[model samples]
Target chain A: MSSIVSRNLKIYFRDKSAVFFSLLGILITVGLYFLFLGDTYTDGLADFNHPEIFMAGWIMSGLLSITSVTTTMGAFGTMVQDKEKKIYKDFYCSPIKRSVLTMGYIISSAVVGLIMTAVVLVITVVYLAANEAIVISAMLVVKMILLSALTSLSNTAMALFIVSLINSEKAFSAISGVMSALIGFLTGIYIPVGNLDEGVQMVVKCFPTSHSAVLFRQILMENSLNEGVKSYPAAAQAEALAEVKDVLGVVFKFGETECSAEMSLLILVGALVVFSSLSIFTLNRKKTA
Target chain B: MNKIVQVTSLKKSYKDVHAVKGLDFYVEEGKLFAFLGPNGAGKSTTIDMICTYLRPDSGKILLDGSEVGKNDDEIRRKIGIVFQDSVLDPILTVRENVTIRGSMYGLHGKELKEAVENACEVVGMTDFMKRPYGKLSGGQRRRVDIARALVNTPKILFLDEPTTGLDPQTRVNVWNTISDLQKQNNMTIFLTTHYMEEASDADYVVVIDDGKIAAKGTPAQLKEKYAGNYLYIVPKNKDSLLNTLKKNKITYKQNIDTISIPIVHTVDSLEILDKVRENIDSFEVIKGTMDDAFIGITGKEIRR
Candidate 1:
């Protein structure tokens, strides 16, 4: 299985175009936010001294989350291409277990997701600092590191579930395009959850990745949120923060139940368990020609 | 002879189509076995089941005395297959492809490297082992695939139409490789091909069609049993040819392209041609062959 994992990693890296194209998804997302969407978003959050950093933090976290997804989806392309070319026939008939093959895909995809996300994190931190935004503390930095690992893991699991149902590299590319585009809307990076209608906001809160994005906003935006409210009267500031928290998915709502940050973390964990099991179950039934 | 494989009452179906109805055959140790059939004749389906890639509807298959579906991993460890289509990773070098296949068989460290090297040496692919698989010619590509399969040191090597599309020279190259592997390593080979001439070298031949065995025997035995020497004549006027042969009481069979008269006497060959000379466009004394045996047994053309 380790051999299979290493083989997948080698194949993915050897195809320089595939690595570039996979990162292309997140790169395009960043370009769109900067060239067209960033100033529009910054202008709305004028109450803060560095609304640019506040918006950058929110968008950058969303970029990291979606980068894990598209990159991992690219990693699974090796598996899909093998199936397409009938290379799996040799592997399937060999003295190797199907579970081992599945593990190969999962492990390689997790590694790619984490590596690319780390690159995105570094650039983001440097960019925010250059703009004289609120600095990231060592404690928040530690939390981001842990969250980066978890986000990659969950995204790999989720990608595996989606990829197992697909059998062609062409179909994978088409679906990845749709998924990459939907990421911005779902994460509320394009439009704040506060600006959206109640119905649309509910949809955002329901997605597991949106919960991850909300976690980043709570921590990275913590200082900016506090700074925005310092000039308000005490009573008005408290009420406004409460409303902001609910609207921005800082606390997810299930009909009448408002979920805390710890509950959202539980959702990420649940997604990991559910998607991993689902992918494995589906892969066991997969028939190779 | 020791039986390397024993199959009984094997059957398989895909939805409404029954690909293999009932299959039963055994391969002997250190010999080449041929599964011969035309396209859509269930040749691949039977091979797939025998290699444990597909499950049979109901059957008992034993590889080296272990039940196939029951002892899958054990059987897999003992057998290796070269698929009809090349299955190597195009971007990967020959060494990487071979080593990965070796690792699946539990080879590691020095043992794995040695196996890959030995297999490449066996297939004469050592010079090109560093090249990417996609860059090799059709013949070289297949040799690399053979090396990858050989790295496992399997007891029985299954070649699924191993030389189907190569040029005559390259086809001979692959066959020579197989023959040498069998002689030196004493590896048992079970191959499937529709080419009758290719199966001539096989020790045992099983002809399958419409999900059943059409015929089975040694190539020589089949020729003796189903076909006999005959004189072939292509006549322009069928009625005149039939009348001439019938009036002379010559035993013959009428086919689409030619009329064939059994050659009971070697000296009578010229006389038979002489009798049909007036009505015939061409004539020849056709020696019986494995192809004729196949046509005789199946009552259908072997080649499409």
Candidate 2:
């Protein structure tokens, strides 16, 4: 495992384009956030108390999801390149196990996600502190970083599953693009899901991205459970609180308008495990086929 | 000699086309066996199946007396394949490629390093160890690939058209490297090529034509059986030479300016030589070559 990780790291370091794109994602997210909120701040700090300002932070979190998609796109495309060059044949014929190859690719993708997440987190925290909107605690920062990593794992697994099914690069790009667009639009990354038709909202809610984006928004925009739940209205807020209680069970007491951080984290972790298992199963089946 | 590899009734079809018909052959241990065929003659398909890259539709492959299809991993561990196309990573250096291949065979640390060094030395690639594989010339890249396969110290090696696109000098170099490896390691080699000269040097040769075994024997035996000893003549006046041979009842086969007749007796040779002396420009009495045998047996040109 260490050897695999070291080899992946070495390859990653040699890829200047990959490093540049990672930094590009970070810069784009920071630049867009500051551009929109630059005029609103009195001095150098953001006003997190304002409803519009808080919503803007949520929008920034949704945009960060694009980075997750981009990371997977690059990693999966590299896999295709390896196949074209017959480099995969060398590894396949070796004594190395198939599981190791799958895990190595997934872990390397997760590492890239972690790096991008850290960049976004550091810039957001420093920017928020400078604007005097809110102070971030070390514990909250740790939780946010862990959530980011989980989100990355889930996205990478999804990409791996797609790659296992298809061998052509053009087909991979087309399918991954359609998937990213659908997930992004359904999760309200570009347009608010609540503003859509009632039927559309119902359809979007069934998607994992809808739940994931909601959880991420809760973390980045509102630090407290009460503030997180206040984004919705009476009936929806009550339903969210009930779902949180069901997930928490014996962990925490559920108030009239409150969400549970531990419950959201559990859902993310579960989704990651299921997607990763599916990806591995698909890869094994393809190998025999 | 003990048989090291046996392929029985091996068959593979691609959609509507049968790439490899029911084929059977065996390789003896420590022998250099050559598979000779033209383009699209199923040579690559056979190699691919034996290397476990492609599964056969119906057949049994035994390597060292163990069934290969049933024990693919073990069989693969004992065999190394150098594909017609380059398979080395362009981003990696020659040394890194060798080390990674060695590690794949469960070697590591000092053992892996020494194994990689030995493989490089055999392929004469030690001086270019640190160079990026992509930076090297085509022949150099091919040498790196050979070293990569040898790093595992496999019991059997497969070379698929190993010298196919190389210049004459580079081809000689590659062949020399292969010869040295065979002698130094006592390795069993299975090679495929279209060059008749290349096949002539093998310990055993199998000629495949249209997905079937057209002929199989040592170079000397094949020449003796399919190609009979003959006297060749290139006459200056083709019409007069043909008239004389036909009028004299001389049994001969004519192809353009060349005419060949079987050696029946030395008594008739002086009479025939004198009769054609004025009309003929060149004449030779020599043994038949492998090319002649191929043409005689297959009844088709060995198109590249």
Candidate 3:
């Protein structure tokens, strides 16, 4: 299984086009943020004391979620190709257990997700300090890294479940396109939950991936939001922080209850477990031609 | 010789199509066994079950005394398969592709390296091992596929249409490699091929048609039973040849310019040739062929 993992990683990284396209989602998001969305978002928060810093964290958090979704999908392109070309049947002839082969694909995709998300995390921090002129502490960076791992694993499991159903490259490509386009809306990065329809907002709150974005936002914007409202009166600062959290998706509400950080973390862990088991079951049950 | 692979009442179905219908066959140890059939005649279905790639709907498959489904791991460890199409990762170098397959069977370190090297060397691919699989030509790719299959030094090698689409020279090369494995390494080869001439060299041949055994025997036995030996004579005078055959009470088949007479043996052609020497302009004796046997048994030519 380790050898399979190593072989998959080598092939993925060796293909320049595949690696470039794997990161295409993050590149597009960052381009959108740089060319227009950045100013528009900061301008919406014009009255805030530190709009640049807060919006930077918000956009960067969304970028991490996008990385988690797309990189793993790109990694899984190998598995789908193996099936499409009947290469999996060759592997089936060997003594290796079917479940071990499934784990090989799963573990490799997770590794890719983790690595690519870490690269995005670094770029996010650099943008925070260089563009927003905000220097977060080492402790904050550690927390973000930990969150990236959770988000990467959670999203990788979800991608695996979807990929297990696909046998052809065309189907995988279609699923990838749909995933890239819908992820932003699902994570509330393209449209804030408060601005959407109640039905869509309910989906955003219920969606497990949206919780990853919320967790990221909670960590990335913790210092920026506090600093942005530090000059306000004590009572006013509390109200301002709460309002900012709601507006930027740092917190999700189901009716009157605000989802706590613990709940959001639990959701991510739950997504990892539920999706991983589901994917394993689907993969094992599938027979190759 | 001991039976290396045995199937009893094995059956498989694909919805309405019964791909394999209670087929029974056995392959002996260290012998070249050929499984011949027309397209979609359940050749692949049978091989898939024997290779442990698919489960038979009913009946038993035993490999070296181990049941197929019940002891697949132990059985798989002793067998290797070369699929009709290339299955190695095209993006990977030939060495990497073979090495990964080797690792799957638990080969590692120096042992794995030597096995990979030996496999490639056997297929005459040692010089091109570093090249990407996709970069190789069709024939080269076929050789690499063989090398990948040989990496485990399998006791039984199963090749499905191993040379279906290759130039004559390359087909002969692949055939030589397969022959070497059986002769020099003493490996048991179970081959499914569309090329009848290739199956002519097999120790035993089984031809299936419409999901059932059409014929099974040594190549000569099958040809002698289902196919025939014939003598063809182009007559100098058609009327004179007809009179001679009729006067001699020899049964014959007449074509536009030639008459054919079935002969029991090659020497019998001499007797018929002597009788028709005065009336024949040219004459030739044709032995029964594997292709003829295939056509005779299946009632159709082998599909591409």
Q: For residues B77-112, what per-residue lDDT tens digits would candidate 3 score against the true structure?
A: 898899988899888999999999999999999999
Error of 1 at B207 (Å): 0.8
Q: Measured with DockQ on alpha carbons, how good is candidate 1?
A: 0.74
Steric clash pairs (candidate 2): A44-A131, A45-A131, A45-A132, A46-A131
Clashes of 3: 0
lDDT per residue for candidate 1 within B264-287, as digits (tens), equals 544678887777777879877766
Worst 10 residues of 3 chain B by lDDT: B263-272
Evaluate all candidate structures by whole-model CA lDDT and list the values in order. Answer: 0.84, 0.71, 0.88
Say what the interface RMSD of candidate 2 is. 1.8
Writing each residue's lDDT as its tens digit, candidate 3 over A125-226 gives 888777653567888878888999999999999999999889899999888877877878888887667778889998888889889889888877877888
Clashing pairs in 1: none
Residue A18 of model 3: what lDDT?
A: 84
Query: What lDDT does candidate 3 reach at residue A36?
Result: 88
Model 1 misplaced stretches (Cα beyond 4 Å): A134-137, A167-170, A224-259, A284-289, B232-248, B252-260, B264-284
* Candidate 1 local lDDT, A103-158, one digit each (tens): 88889999999998888878877776676444767987788888878888888899
